[model samples]
Structures are given as structure tokens and as C-alpha cells.
Target: MQVKKADGSDYEPNTISAFQRSIQRYLEEKSNLSILKDKEFDSSRTAIAAKRKSLVQSGKGNKPHATKFLTYEDEEALFSSGQFRDHNPEVLQRTLWWYMSLHIGFHARDERHKLC
Candidate 1:
């Protein structure tokens, strides 16, 4: 089995063997082969998840669970406040289109698709 880095990078095969050896040595010393059979793996998975969640919340993770929804009036006030009032029509239209896409859940990755 492969072990992931704390930052969630992929494991090299050599690193996996080293990790397995360390865990095996520790378990042998503890007389806890049962961890290999079950509980510790589950615990480790939970720990990884918790760490990832913490990183995401702390803004150290690049992925975006970072934004919250805006209230309707707040959103309206923001877009209607004349920020783009002097911009060309095409620019305002594109900006509004992007705002609508994001509001409807088209995120960073999804914005690349043809708007069909």
C-alpha cells in the first residue's frame, strides 16, 4: 500500500517501502500486528482527513472550499454599485456572465468549458 505525504503528494515506490518498513518495525516492537489487519489504518485515514481539512480551512491548501455564498441583496449591491459603469458593454456583459456562472456553482475548473 502507498502512503501519502502530509501535503497529499503522491508516494514514490521507494518511499512506500520505507514507510512500510518503519510501520512494520514499530508494530513489531509494539506487538500490534492487528493494526495491519484493521483499526490503525482506519485511524490513520481519519487523521489524514482531519489534517487535510485543517489545511483547507487555514487557507494553506490551494483548493477552494474557502468561499461562502453571498446574500441576494448583498450580491445585487456589489454588482450594481457601478464598478464597471464606465467599462464597455462587452466587458460588463462578460463580467456579469462570469458572476452568474460562479453564482450557479461553475467553479474555477468548470469555467473552462464552452458555455453551451
Candidate 2:
């Protein structure tokens, strides 16, 4: 599968690993920024803590679970009816945005704890 970066760059190889590395780098930068901005430290730390608690409560933090993917039949139906592409575009977009946001947030929290 091909992965597209936010900057419109395309990368081939292991997309999961690439995304992980990108999140790591982002977290590192965020951590450095947090360290320099002592005034915002508490707020940032609290936000991270809340997210950590949420993930734990949801049974998704550091636990092995089945990764959900769109099935071939689902994809075919979506493409054929154009439901996901048109009628529910907002839902699809929002879902993707949330997924990326949560992934990045959790990854950043992990990196912050590691650094600490």
C-alpha cells in the first residue's frame, strides 16, 4: 500500500512503521517544546494524562486486540453505491481525522513518558 504524507509526498514500504516514526518525531518535538514552555506544562501534562486514562478505560492501551479493517465486500459495496464516497463523506473524513488525532496523541504521550 502507498502512504501519503500530509505534505502530499508519497512513500512506499511499511506504512505502519513510517507512521510510527513520524509520530515519534512529532512527539519528540512536542516534548522539547513542552519542556521549554513551563507555563503550558501543566495543561499539556493534564491533557496527556486524560488521554492515557481514556485509552486504558477503553481497553486499547498496550493491549493486543484485533485491528478492524474494511472488508473487501464492504469496500465493493461502498464503491458501487458511492455511499461512503458521497453520502457519508463527512463521516468518513471525520473518522479518519479522529483516528489520526488519537493515534498521534497517544504516541506523543508514550514518548513523553519515555523521555521523562
Winning model by lDDT = 1
Clashing pairs in 1: none
Candidate 2 residue-wise lDDT at 46: 55
lDDT of 1 by residue, 14-116 (tens): 4444565688789888875744456757776465556555555655545345667768886667569754343778657767775677767675665556553
Clashes of each: 0, 0
Ten residues in a row with the worst lDDT in model 2?
9-18
RMSD of each: 10.7, 18.3
Q: Weakest 10 consecutive residues, lDDT, candidate 1?
A: 11-20
- Candidate 2 residues 49-83, lDDT tens each? 55546545655444344345667896577657654
Once model 2 is optimally superposed onto the true structure by TM-score, how far is the C-alpha of residue 4 displaced, in angstroms? 18
The C-alpha stretches of model 1 lying farther than 4 A from their native spots are 1-65, 84-90, 99-108, 111-113
